[model samples]
Target: MTRFAVVAMMAVALVGCGGDGGDQSQEAAPEADAAPAPGTVTIVEPADGAELDAGPVIFVMETEGVEIVSAGNMDPGTGHHHLIVDADVDWTLPIPNDPGVHYHMGLAQTEFTVEDLTPGEHRIIAVVADGVHIPLDPPVADTITVVVR
Candidate 1:
């Protein structure tokens, strides 16, 4: 498997580990006996308004049953994460999973690898979407700002 695929698989494993048991499909039914709780999203790294250096790929998140439904453009009520660099980008657009400008973790994992950022001020925001890859109505997370030196 390719390096990216390996990383992706590992991410999926981690996410699945936290799952409460259901089919592999992101569209899987919430659980028969338990009603699906209102999911939440949060950035675990580079906290809100953090400063970072350019080099290692940083991990961002949208927690709460987060899944990546598309490598580009997050589907509504679905899955995924987008890394915005140098500017404010919309989380609702169908941005491709280009490793250069954007890292798309489609329904595979919540973990992100943010490597090779240019020296300057940049912002990273993570959003959690539902099964269709759309951002949650209220948006699962807040935009995190970071400075890369």
Candidate 2:
């Protein structure tokens, strides 16, 4: 082939060999906007290891991919919040309704206030439980420690 013809053929081959002309930006968009996985829960306030003055402690909780409903709803993918304070949890059994230890938010409330903490360090855990106050399988919870002065 002539010099010009050979160069033209090489140019066409290079262009054709390039990647599939799909938009890379579109391919990455979904991952950036993806929703949280099912049963994801987190504590939004009073960051871990926080130190605060002794008094009423307010807790703010958040959940993703799970619906917060009143206790006894018995609906799939739905439950309420429970605040476990400075106590060991029995994941296989129903959370007890004990004061100053296991606080159940049966009304689907996301915020809670604890007014009975003594001055010291305390372990706080936010747990999501089913309508019957039983924790979900695989256990959706967030634990943090805070010191009260």
Task: Provide the TM-score for each candidate, comma-separated.
Answer: 0.55, 0.75
- Local accuracy of candidate 1 as per-residue lDDT tens digits, 1-149: 69999999998987878653323445445677676554556677777666776688566564455444554544444555655554444557554446666555664565777767777766666656544445565566556667777
lDDT of 2 by residue, 23-132 (tens): 22222233565664457577877899999899999998877667788999889777889999999889989999998999999998888899998999999999999999
Model 2: runs farther than 4 Å from truth?
A: 1-36
Cα misplacement distance, residue 85 of candidate 2 (Å): 0.7
TM-score attained by model 1? 0.55
Model 2 vs. true fold: TM: 0.75
